[model samples]
Target: MKTDLKLNVLSVGNTSTGSRSLPSQFAEPIRPDLVKRAVEAIQGNTRQQHGSKKEAGQRHSAKLSRRRRDYKTSYGHGISRVPRKILTKRGTHFSWVGAVAPGCVGGRRAHPPKPIKIWAKKINDTERRKAIRSALAATLVKTLVAQRGHHVPPQYPFLLENKFEAIAKTRDVIEALEKLGFNDELNRSSEKILHAGRARRRGRGTRRKKGPLFVVSNTCSLIHAVQNIPGVDVVPVHQLNVSLLAPGAHIGRLTLFTEGAIERLEKEKLFMQEYKNLHPPVPPAPQSPASHSKLQNPSNTQKQSQPTQQKTQQPSALQPQKKVSPTKAPSTKSKPASQMTLTQLTK
Candidate 1:
């Protein structure tokens, strides 16, 4: 079945100039599992490697002896066997405290984060490509978009005319967005709030709602114009990824595509292979004996019919049939793997 999915291309004035068919990527199956994995993999790759210093909290020269009657001996001291630091001594009695243990003060952590530890999660190339296609498909889904807390326009899957890329001023970009019925969304994203808890002190002082993403064919003046707007991001179609489209492993983001970007997607055939598999070609039906006889000559008909009979009989003889054991019955319970959803599997 062919999908006649199309998006209306709006001009700068929010007037519908024309409609164009959506690319095959938009028709890809919504595999939330792949999308989440791709997003996580991208995030993991960007994480900075961090670890505690090797000699941190372990430079103390203090030592304790376990041998009895030995100087600074911790054994038979009426205290637990542990490394101790001596403070003051009088005769055979000495004042000391435990050290170098995780439970003790100024001690090394039991399992500190190591810089050598791998943080990046590997994803198959095909899976990553499928994920990008899934994320792109989610953008066209109204339910998914709304679930992501985006204020969408009445006409979903918004597409813009090529002229939008010519916008050079931030004011013009805001005005164009307002005229396109995005005033509510613009206002929503503009309301920034102070981050809760320690996040504010950790450099993420303010947080704002994610607004519509502008996807263009190439670098243009509009990129500068829209970037200044709160929560608005301008990304070229070639650089599109699951993380950008489905932030925080959540599927669906309000996206605006330029006419040129849509054309480029079709021309490049990105994610076309995955899309083709979603709709496989149906196999031809088997021909009946009457129809088969009509297609063949009278003399050859007997020969063809004999082979067809033999072919059907051969499968029964060649194929091994399993003996049903009366003692055992097939399990009705579904396998955990088969029962798991994409989100659960990804997690």
Candidate 2:
């Protein structure tokens, strides 16, 4: 079945036993947008919420008096508006030290994180599934896997046989991985880094490099074998998620699939939407008669006919409107010289 497929099933001894065709999910187009969204949503959903204690900084009774003789009051005292409690008193005077206010020695924070605040993000089901498919396709691309900093072998993106899943010893698993050309990859991930100076102070001291992923059909001995390996992960096919597929929201992680896992993926159709649950087609609305449709609403029919009726009722251009005759004004100074009489002109 490997006719056009470039994938091969590798035995525990690192020999190609047969070829296997990739599922349609592997042919999905790579979409970084969807992948990033899904990964971020997962990260946000996994975030733990924390906040300051309820009684923090409010444990002390720092109330002060406003009387003239009271030293606790800031009435005559040349002190700031900060609330202070009398720690030590002597006769008529008292020691009023600042506390219970912001900027004081031990005061409540202006704003603190609230444990009730939601930190999770949500994405559509179809979008999340598409993102997973995209990530799966990204795994097969040699350029992407290499770009993700994995030590890719000559036969990159090959699947392991079901027999490989039976090995329970970590040493045997390492030997098999080394034979499959992952020795350098394993060595690279094994080395740890101790952050220096400020980075260490920020709790980032020890770090391990991310390594290749192993995907299998179910919980098997392989899962426990790789548990001791740094950055090496083995997840069952059904439990696959965006975070596992593309760690840190970056596309493409070196992934090894077991032959049984791929077959299970095809059988279960993981992450793909099911068609049986879709809504049944609604029966087509019965066609109504043209006359009845036009008369469905009297208001609409009136509104449409009003304009056409006005156009038809308008008089034709052949009959022109009569012009209003202008009335003559009293003669006096308004009359022109030619129209005025000879005696009137002399006057």
Candidate 3:
């Protein structure tokens, strides 16, 4: 006997059950652990590296000194009376051992080594597939259960549906949803889908392209769409804490076209237009003169006539040039503090 799991078509939130109008297979109970593992695996696969810090050793040079000599006396003093045996260099003091002579103690190391993780874990194929399926099932079930029993804001809905119409472009997606019996008003902008949560890969292909999608107006429509597709999962954007939407029923493409839905869509468009008007205009892109040869060099016909050129250059020619005087530089005689101004003395 084919073991029957009544799967509470409605309780499961499949479109066939009427909770959501999307695909039907999504209306089953999904395991949370499986969903979590699937998400983790995807995240692991998409993990980005900081890239190696090959220049870290060079950065350490800024923190340490680079002097070779050790004594301060090496720099000739004003007086010759100082003993030649005195071992001071120009920059270093008597106490400084670094500059005393050729063979001296070395300075401290600029950078020290630190410990960090360098390896990532690889998830098994069987576990990944199981997790994705579980997450989708959980999402649909939660939506069906919440529709009547629990109340939440329409704008901040319980689940965020990410539909990939299999048919490319946004218009086709909207049409598909309408055909599935959802109202146009129920559909939100594509931007909302990105904000709510990102789409998860079905694991078969690395390059999964989104055709066109929008949020389902009713939970019934949403579940139906999800239940149909394999490997796809949906969960409430705000709370990853709950169920997942399942896909296996092979639900067909959806579209929206119910009564009064057009009016709602117009209002949404108006609101978007008004919001766009409030934003400042984007500045024009900077054009590269070198890339366009015509822009760099003007036509000879447009050049100023010889008479006009002479007129423009006359004033510049007549202007008297200032002669830079060869004033003798001041001798290096030290002035007494009393002779200096208050500012000079303070400095």
TM-score ranking from best to worst?
A: 1, 2, 3
The local distance difference test score of model 3 is: 0.35
lDDT of all predictions, in order shown?
Answer: 0.85, 0.86, 0.35
Q: Who wins the TM-score comparison?
A: 1
Model 3: CA > 4 A from native: 1-29, 57-90, 93-119, 144-172, 179-189, 192-347
**In model 2, what is the error at residue 141, expressed in angstroms?**
2.2
Q: Kindly list the per-residue Cα lDDT of model 2 for residues 27-95, writing each as its tens digit.
A: 789999999999999999999999999779878888877777665567787777788877898876778
TM-score, per-candidate, Cα-based:
0.74, 0.70, 0.30
Model 1 segments more than 4 A misplaced: 274-347
**What are the per-residue Cα lDDT tens digits for candidate 3 across 1-347?**
11222221111121332222322223334565665555555555556644434443233222212333433343443332222232343534432223212232332323433334433456665565455434434433435424322221232122222333233443543454444433332332111322222333443333321211222322334434554332223322222211222112211211221212222322332112122333578998987766466566656336665554344534366688768899999899979988989998778
What tens-digit string does per-residue lDDT give for candidate 1 at 187-220?
9999978977989889998988889999999999
Which scores higher on lDDT, 1 or 3?
1
